[model samples]
Target: MKALCRDCFWTGDEQPRRCPSCGSMRVVRHEELGVLGIAHLDCDAFYASVEKRDRPELRDVPLIVGGGVRGVVTTCCYIARMSGVRSAMPMFRARKLCPQATILKPDFQKYRTESRRIFDKVRDLTPLVQGLSLDEAWMDLSGTERLHGAPPAVTLARLQADIEADVGITVSIGLAPNKFLAKIASDLDKPRGFSVIGAAEATAFLATRPVGILPGVGPVMVQSLEKSGYRTVGDIARADLRDLADRFGQHGLHLHRLANGQDSRSVNPNEARKTISAETTFNEDLNRAEDLEDQLWPLCEKVARQLRAEGIAGRVAHLKLRRPDFQIVTRRRTLPVPTQTAKTLFAVARELLAAEPKGQPYRLIGAGLSDFVDGQEAGADFFAEGERRALKGEKAVDILRAKFGKGAVVTGRALKKE
Candidate 1:
């Protein structure tokens, strides 16, 4: 087998404890290292890392990026992770766990700027890079060996180092033949890691893992799978096709394929986002429709801002409610035309909210826009004159908010106390 050093990017035939060229202990050896190219790159502790990068004094301190007494954590540094502070954990619990940790409100605009820089670097290597989020992406580097004068592994190692050097943060890389395995491999190691999973060993590798490891298998699905005698991936991998199909329909077939280490989806750089939305968990559940509407307005504004940022418009407006018991209720409406304005999003979602059964307290409220089209399409001949007015008015406010501050403009409904 051959080995490579992540630090020095030195390759040698004999597997050793350290790199002979650089004498570094960060050595990785695999029989199928060079050929595998489909890769997933995840920035380590993205928001917290960016925060620490900007504030050198906090480099060694535990840092968390989130706010609000009731809001869930957005992200936390590895040091905070040691103290049981995790993303999406309640802010109160996080404070109890890491009392000394420095918590900061999220700076999304700054983070997005940094994200573009990082992604641009990846595009330098391969235009096939598909961003899953601001902090993570999938890349296809197949057939680029001659261009870079090295295999995908070596090029990726160099890219990883380049990212850390240029961006001032570390990232982990997972190299595999397909998307499913690649995603799993990325999380095997933390902070700065490089893991590889080959097609040859994928089946045996996934067999022992729990069914919950597979995508789309939530807590409820896990229970259903357990009851169906499918506790592990191996069970599903070996299950009779007809039996699985009879029991689970298409979902069973999907589980069987993924369990056996198969993912046919290709890397798509132009993959259109299906939705742009935001939601907040309330400090306390409220049963009143008026209170929910107050919460819904901010989320509509948020989604509209996101849609505008992405230069897209959605023809579908959606509303979501989660009860105290975790039961979810969703409502959606098709618009006369696509829109990317807070007023339109709010109007559609507010109407949907009014139609839902009354007297139901919801612990969470979310709204989003989907069924997208380019922003240019929003001005089409078929576009309603009212929607055009709403978009124009919202754009003017967006400009004002950008120049002045987020508080530059506020709705009458926005003043309603939570």
Candidate 2:
């Protein structure tokens, strides 16, 4: 299939303005479309889109999802973007740019629920799915044409349509010969876009793009490359490989390969994350340890819930505090046995928090668990009977919360006021 209409799923070689079957102009045509399998699927303005989906009244209005005035924006709708509001911009600045925009605080639980539904649909198409975040993922649909009775492109098109129908959100898809080009192609057209990059055009397409477009090339590295007269991918493509290797070591070699549109990395489903944490930026700065501890309880519960959901346990419990001046202080403690229960996580994190200098006002508090192992590998008997009973009670609370809602049972510490 050299051409497919995204709306009707019609296949042919003819390039037309609209699909003959459905009369929709959403057509995707490519020379290597039928053969290439690697794809990147990115939900458009994920958090904002979910908000718009739930509250259709805000569909046309500009929306920004973020924290308080002192916090940064997590994401914004296209309407807000047209007014120069961007992710990571301070909420105060975003409000200034889009004065009429509606600002909503992030509801991560809702977002995660929607993300899980979307991912389930994706997994139905292919098992080789690598999730990058709640909004984006890389899918390897290689060697599945016979099973699906269609090429990867057609399956991907159908998947996009299915997600929109089932999840009430739009997605952009990129199909290419490799992971690198696929990711880049996905961003070429946005909101509800389908883009393709063939092996024959990868090098030429990458050469004209800025070096910053390459993955892992951050602002600091861009500045360094610009100082060396390397601004575009083509500049690196034309540079001496030996000189680049000598200057930047292995990283330079890696960049050189990517500059030439060569990426050998596979879409591994077993890619492990480095850390899992939950943090909250308070609307008002908290000074007293009691107030901080009250806030800390919920965050600890969140991290524990995530660990249980992922079937992982951690050997280290971490505490993080951001002072009113934005300076951050971090503390960590290693446990003799790994755990996925909030009781242990909170106990360790509370100890770490107590060790910090008291009376210093903090604007943010975070809890994290790291140095992971499979949940089954965690030694539960490390705690005495009473402690174990408390842990079991927490697990029971988790079940009730899942069956009912998050408010099914509230811990005394969480409800305690400073």
Candidate 3:
């Protein structure tokens, strides 16, 4: 067993009620403390935490970070979460559940800046940082003990403390022998926590848990598994791998391995991005194709901005629409060649949108680009001459927008209409 004082960073043996040196009670003790290397780090209510940090008035209060009444909650503070508020819950419903909570708009740019700063701090601890998203990642701190003069667990705890002190945010970490188990452990504690699950207790601990606890098992798959009489990890663990494979095909093999707490997936730091996209839900459902195009244009611009920032281009454009009745329809079209301009993206997306029978109102719209390649291959001759001209115009506009502001350069039609 090992015990460490969080405040003073003191590592010692006895698990005293208080740290012997600093006299602080925020002490953490664990059996596998020093040996574990892989870790999963997730920020504590990230969007909401940033809001609380910048606006101290909302610190102790229940807070939600989202959009208009029509939009959904991007995230909420723990206090709001206690009232059944959750991420992706509609803002209207979240407000009714916690009527007194403060509601704030999401400032994505500010959040991105802070996320990078926090990531840099984590990289200082280890280079095997596999970012899962802006607020979560898997990090392998193997072979770091010689450099840090401490075990991976202690280094991780100190990293969390450093973020809280310097970045004004707290994170929860999960430590285990591999990526999957480490990710599961991280969620066992939250807000500001460090939890561990070692190889010794892994199988036994996972046995009684529901099959839904596995990473890829969603509600639909859980229902299917339950109907087949396999309700828990123990059931799958006991079942024959061949039998599972016969039932679920390739996925059954995956299930059998995970049931025994075996994960072959590694922490990949250089995972390629498959797609980049953004979507927005309307305050009132939109029916007209023109109205949908209005929403689609901005999303395409956003995707183009990301493409430029990443220095990549994509061959295919994707468009998504959700009807008022919750039926989702998606369409994708590959260009004659790849292009990154917002003009080309919108042209392709506009064609797809025109083909959809659009009398029914749409609650959501999204645009994305995929099938990536180098952005240098994206300019003239690859697309229609009209599109080529628009690309040049958009590039000039992009520069002007960067010099001034996005509002300074807007499409003539869009400005007069909106």
lDDT of 3 by residue, 1-418 (tens): 4777778888887778788899988777776777889999999999999989999989899999998887889999999999999999988899999999999888988998999999999998877889988999999998899999988878988899889999999999999888888998989878798888888788898999999998889999999898988999989888888888888988988888888878878778887667888898898999987788888888888898878777888888999988877778999998887777888898889999899885978989989999998877776454467766766787788899999998988875466448
Pairs in steric clash, model 3: none
Model 2: clashing residue pairs? none
lDDT of each: 0.90, 0.88, 0.87
Better structure of 1 and 2 per TM-score: 1
Pairs of colliding residues, candidate 1: none
lDDT of 2 by residue, 1-418 (tens): 6789998899887777789899988889888888999999999999999999999999999999998887889999999999999998878799899999998989988999999999998898888999999899999999999999999999999999999998999999999988999999999999899999998888788887889998889999999998998999999988898989888898998999988888999998788766789888888899888888888888888888888888888888899999888788999989878888788888888898888887888988999999998887555655545546655787788899999998899888876842
Listed in order, each prediction's TM-score against the native is 0.93, 0.90, 0.93
Model 1 per-residue lDDT tens digits across residues 34-81: 778899999999999999999999999999888777767999999999
RMSD of each: 2.1, 2.7, 2.1
The numbered model that scores best in lDDT is 1
